[model samples]
Target chain A: MSRPTRTTEESIARVLPELDYSKIALSLVVMLFFAFFVSPIWTGLVTAFKTTGAVTATTPFVPVLPGTEGFTLAKWTRAIGYLSTGFVNSLAMTIPATIVSVFLGSTAAYGLTLVDWNERLQFGILILFIAGIFIPYQAVLVPLSDFWINLVPLVDILAPVWQLPFLEPDHARLLSLTITHVVYGIPLCMLLFRSYYLTLSDELVEAAKIDGATISRIYRRIILPLSKPMIGVVFIYQFTAIWNEFLFSLTLIGSSSSPAATVTLVLSGMGVDLSGIDFGFRMAGAFVAAMPTLIIYVLFAEQFARGLAEGNT
Target chain B: MAGSQDTATGSRTIGGGETDWRTRVETFSKSDFVRSFPYWFVPFSLVGMGVYGGIGWNTVISLTDYEGFDRPDYTNLDFSMYAQALSDPWVYLTAKNTLVLLIAFTTITLVLGLLLSILLDRGIRYKEKIQTIYLLPMALSFVVTAQFWLWMYNVNNGLVNAVVGVFGLGPFNWIGNPDLVLGAVIFALIWQYSGYAMVVFLAGLQAIPDDQFEAAHIDGAGVFKTYWRVIIPQLKSSSVSAAVVLMVFALKAFTFLYAMFGQYRVPKATDILATLMVREAFMLQHWAYAAAIGTILLVMALAVVAPYLWYQYGQGSL
Candidate 1:
C-alpha cells in the first residue's frame, strides 16, 4: 500500500511537474498584496466618502462600489470645519519643533563629523542619542509633565520678549511636546544627515575655506543647500510623524483646556458602547483625522521612495 | 563672462552685506565670526530640556503623592508609593504581559524576517516590487492600521472569526478575554512589522560579499549546508539590529492596544507599562505612584538596552 502510494505520488509529480516554487510564491505575494494592500487602501479611500450608517451596515463593506451618495458630506465637513482648527494647532507646534530639530540636528552632525575627540566621548554620546531613540516615552511620562510645569520661568522669560500666549502653565504641554519630538527626531535625523553629508566632496569645503568663508558661513552656504535631499526626506517623514503624534499629545496636553487638542484626542472622545462593536464614529473620526498625513504621504510618495532607495543612514 | 565671484556657490546671496558688489568683492571680507552657540543649543536647549524635563517632572510627581483627580499634596519625599506601585494589583500582570508580548513578537519578527530575507536574497525576479509590497504596512500609522485590524478581528463580522468558524471553533473573544487578548495583540503587531525587519535583514544580507557564497559553491557545498554555515553566521549584525529595533517597538506598543481596548478605569491584564503609566498619571491621576512606575520602566529599559547600544553606536553600526 505504501509502495502504491509512493508510486501514485511519483506519478502525480511527473504528470503535473514540480513547478518553480519561487514563482508560485511570487504569485502568492501578488495575491496577498492585492488582497491585503490594495483592498485595504481602496477600502480606506472609499471610507472617506462614506456616511456613518452605510459604513457600519449589516454587510459593512458589501457593495463597496458606493450607491450611497446620501454621503451627506458630513464627515468631511466636520473634519475640516471642526478638526482643522485643532490641526492648525498641531501644525503650529510641529513646524517650529521640526525646523528647530532639523537645523540643530544637522549642525550637531556636522560638528561631530569634523571634531576630533576621545573616541569614547564621541561614540558614547552617539550611543546615548541612538539609545534615546529607543527609550519608550512612557518610561519618562511622569517626570516629563512635572518638568513642563517648571518651564514657567523660561516661559516667563520668553513671555517678556515674545508675549506668546501659549506659554501659560496649563498649556505648556505644547512646549514639552515640541521639545520631546525634537529630542526624538534628532537622534536618527542627525545620524542620517551626517552620514549623507560625509559623502560630500571634501573639495567643496576646501574651496570654501580657500574663499575665506568662515566655518559657520561654510555650513550655511555649502552644507545646508547640499543637505536638501536629506532635509526634505527628514521633513516629509517628520511631518507625517508629528501630525500622527498621539501619546505625548494625549499625555502632556493636560485635559482639554490647553488650546486645541490633537486629532487622536478627538477620536478618543467616542466612548465605548460595550456592544463589542467598533464605534463607527470613532473609525470615521479616525479616518477623517488621519486624512492630512495620508494626503502628505500620497503627495510625497515618489520622494519618499527615492529616500528609501538612498536608504537608511 | 563678467568676473565670476565663486559664482557656483550654494547660498542665498545676502542683501544686508555691503551694497556695492565690487566694494564687497575686491576686499571680499568674509562674514564676521559668530560664536556658534547653537552647538550648545542642541544639547542644552533641545536634549537637555527633555532629559531635565523628564527627571524633574517624574521627581515632582512622585513626591506629590497624588492619586486620580484627587488633590495631590507634595509635602514630602517619601517612597512608600514605589512599594505600593510594585505590589499593586495587576502591576505584576501588566509587566508580565509586556515581557511576553516583547519576547514573542521579537522572536516571531526575527524568524519570519530572516526567512523572508533569505528567500528575497535568492536572486528572485521582481525583488523591488516584492519589497515595496512588504513595506506597505509600514507606511500606515499604527493608529490607522489598528482600526483596520480591529475590523478584521471583529467578533461577529470580522475576518478572524470567519476563518476560525471554518475551522469549527467557537468565535473566540480575541480582544475581550484576558488570556487571549495579549497574544492577539502581539500577533497583529508581528503581522504588521515583520516586513520592516525583512527589509533590514535584506540590507544586511546584501552587504555579505558574493565571494563567500562562491567559495562555498566551489567547495562542493550543497545549498542547505552552505546556508547553515555560511549565511546565518554573517546575518548576526542584522539580527542584533532587528532585536534592538523590535525591542524599542515593543516598549512603545500602545496605539493598537489602546484602540483595541479602550477606557481602563484600572489597568488590565493586557495593559503594558506604557499604557499603565498613562492610565496612572492621565486617567487615575496617581502622580506619585505613576512616576515611580515610570522610573522603574526607564531603569529596566536602560539596564538592558544601554550596553547593547554602546556596542552598536561605538562600533558605528547604527
Candidate 2:
C-alpha cells in the first residue's frame, strides 16, 4: 500500500519554525554583545596563564592552554607572592567593615520603619542616610584625612586620663580607612535593607510589639531571622564594594609599609613599567584581586543582581 | 516642686483627670523615638559626621589658604582658592573633561544597555546564562577592569588592536595617545557598567506586560516600531535611575583612572575634576585648591541626585 506524498504546505507545516531573518539578526547581535562583554576578561584570563614572553609574543585572543610557552604558573606565583599581604589587609579591612556597616545599617533601617516619630523628622533622618549615597568621596578626602591625623591628639589626651592604650597617629591610618569604608558603606546597606524590610508584612513587628518585645528584642528575634536573604544580599553587596574601594584606602592609608595596604592599592602600586609591562604578571594579579567578587558573582549572582537593581529603583 | 510632681503623678489615677503615672511612663517608654533611638543612633551619627560634617569642613578649608600642612589654618578665611580654581587653565580643562565624560559615557552606556536589554527581552534562548555573561563585568573592581583594559589596549598583541587589525584598521596606541586616553577609559567604563544599565533596563522591560507587544503587532507595527513607541517610553524611570548612577560613577572615575595609571597623576587628557582634586591635594599639596574642586564635584553630584530624590518623593516612595 502506497502512502500519499505530503504537499509543500504540509511539509512546511511538519517542520518546526525556522528563525526568520530578524530573529537570526537578533541572535547575532546578542551574541556579538555578549562576545564583546566577555572578551576582555577572557583575554585577561588567558594572559594570566601565559608566560611573559608568550604574553607579548602571542595573539591575545588565543587561549594559553597546556603545551608551548603559552602556559605557566610563574605569573600566578609571582603575582600572589607580591600581593599576599595586600590580600590579607583587604580581607582584614573588608570583613570587619562589611560586618559593621551591615549591622548599623540594618538596625537603622529597622528603626526607621518601627519609629513613630513625626513624618518630617522621620523623613529627615531617612533622607540623611540616602543623601550619604550622593556625597562624593572627594568631598570628604581632605577633611577626613585631617580628622584621622588629629584624632591621635585626642586619643593621646584621653589615653592617660582614661587608662586606655595610646595609638600612634600613623598606626591609626588603617583604622581610619576601615572606618571610612564602613561609614561610606552604610548608606547603601541601609538603603538595601530598608527597601527589603519595607516589603515584609508589618504583622511580625506589630505582634512583637504587642508581645512586649523590646526594639532590640524584636530585631534580634523576629526581623533578624526573617532577614537572612536581605542580609546575604547586603553583606555581599557591601563586601564587594568595600573590597574594591581604592580612593579611601589610598587616601587614608597611603602606601604604608605594613600589611595595611589594600589589594587595590597594592595592585595599583604595581606601576606600569616604562619599557614594557609584564602583561602576564599584571593579568595574574588582576585575576587574583578580582577572584573574591568573581566568586560572589558566580555563586550568588541572583542576590547581587537583585541588590543592585533594588538600589537603583 | 515636689508637690507639683506628686500632683502630676496623681493626675494619672484610674479614671481621674489623666491616666496613672505608670501609664504615662509606659507611654514614654513606648514612644517610637525612645524605642528606636538606639537602633538609629550609630548609623545616623556616623553618616552625619563622616559625610555631611566632612563636606562642611571641606567648605571651610576651601575658604582659607591652607596648604602643605597637617592642619588647615582657618585664620585668614577667604575664597581665594575658589577664585584661583576658576581662573586656572587646568581647572577649566578638568571641568570640561568631567562634563564630557559625564555626558558621553552615560549616553553611550545607556543606549548600548537599552539595546542589549531589548534583545534579551525578546525571547532570547539561554536567557539567564546570557544575561549573566553580560553582567559579569559589573561585579569586577575598578582596579581589575583597569588592569585588564591596559593589557587589552596594548598596541602590540592586544586583543583590541588585533580584532580591529582584521578589519584593516591600524594599531591604535589607546592609552599612550592623549587624544585616545579618555575615549579608552570611557570604553573600559562602559564595558564594566553597561551591564548594570542593561540589568536596570531589562527589569523595566520585563515589568511591561506581554499584551502591549501583542496589541502593537495586531496594529500592524513592526518589532522595532513596537519597542520604540510602546516599550521604550515605559523605561523612563529605569533610564533616569540608571543615568543618575552612571553619571555619579563617571564623576568618581578618578579612582579608576588613578588605579589604571597606578598614581594620582593620570594623563592630562583623562583628567576630570575628581582626578585633578586628588592630584592637587595629595600630590601638589594644594589643599585649599583641591577643596574648592571637591566642592564643585559635590555640587555636580548633588545636581544629579536632586532630581532623583524629587522623583522618588513624587512617587511617594521617599
Highest lDDT scorer = 2
Question: Which candidate wins on DockQ?
Answer: 2
Tens digit of per-residue lDDT, candidate 2, span A235-270:
988899888888888887778245567888889877
What is candidate 2's DockQ? 0.43
DockQ of each: 0.19, 0.43
Q: List the residue pairs that clash in candidate 2.
A: B12-B19, B12-B20
Worst lDDT window (10 residues) for model 2 chain B?
B1-10
Compared with the true structure, what per-residue lDDT tens digits does model 1 show for residues B15-96?
A: 4344445444532342221223354235534664565456556666676677654445677668787778767877887788
Candidate 1 Cα errors over 4 Å, as ranges: A1-21, A33-63, A68-82, A117-121, A150-176, A201-211, A255-259, A271-280, A299-313, B1-37, B56-75, B122-126, B220-226, B264-267, B313-318
Error of 1 at B9 (Å): 32
**Fnat of each candidate:** 0.26, 0.69
Q: List the residue pairs that clash in candidate 1.
A: A143-B57, A143-B58, A146-B57, A147-B57, B68-B284, B68-B285, B68-B286
